[model samples]
Target: MELDLFRWRFVHWQFMLTRPSNYTAGNIGGSVSGVKIAFLGNGSYAFTVTGNSNPDGSIYNSEEAITSQTTGRLYGAIFVRHWDSYITPQRQTIFYGSLKKDGSQYALSKVVNVLKGTNLESPVPQFGSTDNFDVSSSGIAFVSKDPVLQPAIFTKINAYFVPLTDFTVASPPSPIQIQTSGFNGQATSPVFSPDGKQLAFLRRKSVQYESDKLQLFVLTDVAEPNSTINALPTADQKGAWDRSPSSVFWSPDGKTLYLTAEEHGRVALFTLEPPSVTANSSSLPKKVFYDGAISSAYPLSNGDVFISGSNLVDNSIYFHYDSTSGKSNVLSSNAKNGTVFGLSRSQISEIWYPGAAEGTQIHAWVVKPSNFSATQKYPLAYLIHGGPQGSWEDSWSTRWNPAVFAEQGYVVVAPNPTGSTGYGQGLTDAIQGEWGGLPYEDIVLGFQYIEENLDYVDTSRAVELGASYGGYMTNWIQGHDLGRKFKALVTHDGVFSMVSQLASEEQWFPDHDLEGPYWKNPSSWLKWDPSAHTANWSTPHLIIHNELDYRLTIAEGLAAFNVLQQRGIESEFLSFPNENHWVLKPENSLLWHTAVLDFINKHVGLPTYSEQSSYAKQLRSEAWQNRKGDLGRKV
Candidate 1:
């Protein structure tokens, strides 16, 4: 969409020469593929395209092979499969074309590959998008993982500056590397200044540890002439900063930088001057605003910052903050969160309980049902967050949402344990080599704190659930004392074995978390292995695994389910073959929720899913049949 800033509206709405059916919508599935990125700049346009077809629009023969007849994958390298899909000859790449005029609308002409001659992939696989690349008037800067490194065990992604010479160059000029002073991690979130003179990005020190602190850097003299095409341009790094920034962008004046980092379970916005301005000041980076999670903060030319964010109750909110006046004006929000959905800020709160470690306080979000009453006890729905490095932030989510579960007549307590981010880096780093030790104790202590203090929460009738790392914790709980406390457990895309987890595509993850290879350090992996305690597994379990979850793989969940069955423990297996790590489709999400809720409801002695729905239906049916009499009696 091209906007006319002067008029504060759109001039030409359609940018595509030929409108594609759908890039991401579930409906209208025929003759469609996804458009990952569509960038318009410098009289040329670029896009990241994904499909089974070639440049000539010819479908690949390998993709058309008969799967039922004969099939086998023979490969010699790591990352043969990453994230969701198996390795294919074709990978998603950036394509560029001339910005042509289609009547009154601006559109892209027939395009050519940007990384044609290079052994690089843009919009980095699995979890990257428009932010992975930035376009300016002179060139395009993008971050791609080390082409020669073993992606399974190493993580080093560098930002490349492509000085554009032509839109249809068969092989574009060799892209130069924007060096980050020997940083060995992904140089992500590269953002070009408004004038295209400078590029700011974020990088880390450790390649293997994905959760390492992201240091901010700015590359100056970006448009300087270079005789050597792929020359390395040194970037200025911010070393004194303690917190890792997730997003980075230049201020409107181009003298300062704005960043957002997770702080105390909140994504706070911060502003810092460039090193050249004044580097040694203790107050270099100052916190701006962080009531809820600030997803985006755009500095206006007039000094006000436009921001968008959400909290536990509100789904979405937009506001503009004027630092001069120190005031925030609400532009828009999901007012319907309360008016239509009957949700309120009062229903959600926070509790900081002592963790297993002395002086270690773990934060948790406590959500009560809309009609909660202190006189009555409510079943506890304890939610564990994934990422171990990830925290249950003050934000809204579509999946594993605490609000949705609370609305279903339960009190949701989602805890951010020892390893959770947004807290100090020390707590997060402490989880290293002790994934199942201290963090597990933090979770246990968190529950114990609730049981002993939260009077209205019935911990005995609780359902503990989580996905990914949280899933791994639930699996760990199944073989421990905490499993006995919950009525049932739900584990989604979780790891069941420590040794078997090395089979995952990203070996660097288990490598770092477990400290080393299982063969080299057996105790490091074995001491925390969920499989080691299978002899103690007696809890009712709902295991959910997807076929495309290459992180943990389906084997983990299947192994857990088989163990449950062999032990004659009450368990059910839920599989989504079409989905990946998450249930994306609407219908699939509905099924996922139903299966999970039904299993938990059954174990907790609450009404089953169908029973709850049927009872509600019966009430409506009886009221409908006697509407006239009911109205007359009421009158």
Candidate 2:
């Protein structure tokens, strides 16, 4: 298990990766001719792991049972069930074989399924993996998702191409789709380059916006999948860069391409080079490092790179960089070398202000409170983030962490409103079809810029939390006028209607941000629905909802906790039923951060987990890390 297996990041491999049993829910990539494993497809059948080279005997199990759904009655679709099981036609195939070295024990011969009866399927649902497929000694580029549309109204995906066969041949090799030099929609992170004849991917043309803008295809020769496609800046090429990256790595010598994007609110690191193999630049992609949020980039073979990042009071760091003095050197950190998660970087800061359009500009993140003080005032928290096109960056987060609510004496903030995402894409497409109009006026101007310019924030002792579309803007500011200024509100797994979000299975995200299918556009989603402004309900909410989320499903948190319990307001619902749409176990994230910090510490007066403190009861501990460099990883 000490596999350097011949350094892959800098490319120098041979092959031997069969040590991670129990199948593989993702990532195992190897292909000078074998070893490719990736798991999970179950709803009925799923298994794919091969390594052919057979010296003889023992293990090789590839179970696939889909005798064509023999009637269990389930039809009319847009994804039978998505972000948490159900869709079962038993997809996810890829099997290949050979690795028979007998004596010291080894076996897995003949195998097969390389898209067996080709309609193609792969690690592409609920976000695919093993970077959606690669494998080299000549062929295997993968990237399914478009098994002929309908998976919630389209986002293409395609990319195919098979060609290395040897399962004693007979059926397998019609794959070939890779012709995306015309920038198709959704294709996704293919990789391949370090001499697999080239193949780097990331595409997007919006089959109805999934936060479009990825475009960065590279495919020369690829040994053949409709080969030669040198497209780099051609959409009327001349200055193509409005950025939207988030994936694309390779540069150890495939002539450059680093990517990663999400700029202003930070996620940086760029590099590219495809203006027909540039030697003088102009195909854009060149921002190489600009302070934190990196999330991986390896490269190195002299043109150094390493990287690993985090911020907002640090949870990890490790730099290196030095592409000949472009600067970055800080080789290790968990905030600081000797480990002092008592957090720092002066308790994080960065604001920006004003945005709801006209002269736009919004981005927030503030934190403070590792026992912070300048004549203490604290108690604000705020926090609303959940990909209404995501962005409350300067990283570090293990679910709603603003330094664990600034260690609970509060002062958190977090905004990035106007549909976040490293700012700039016209304020992230100004929340497409204007979600509740201008990200709810950039979150009521980030709570009127912390109730009119912070003074150690208090906002009448605020609270407000959020999940999924920040739980539909905590059920759209509880009912608006920003729920008469929150003293409480949480909402995980959000969205409570717009025609019960057609029980979500990703209908191209409410058919492009609630502008199309609610029975063919129900007034663009009952015009910014929070159950259509429930006669401005009195807020004291806290409805968590999970039951395998299915993207805003558990009946949108039981219709906003049965309309705040039949309008008598003061709500509270919290379900889990084995979680989904996040609440990822660890004793259910310490019973969801002790039921969202004890219902926002009993509505902001503070101290509730039995009158807190003991580092807020070591965030529900097993002495298993809660402070100091925070819960290991999951930023």
Query: Which residue pairs collide, candidate 1?
Result: none
Candidate that scores best on lDDT: 1
* TM-score of each candidate structure, all chains considered together: 0.84, 0.33
Each model's RMSD to truth, in Å?
8.5, 24.1
Q: Which regions in candidate 1 have their CA more than 4 angstroms from the true location?
A: 1-71, 100-110, 165-171, 224-238, 277-282, 299-303, 335-337, 614-635
Predict model 2's lDDT versus the native: 0.69
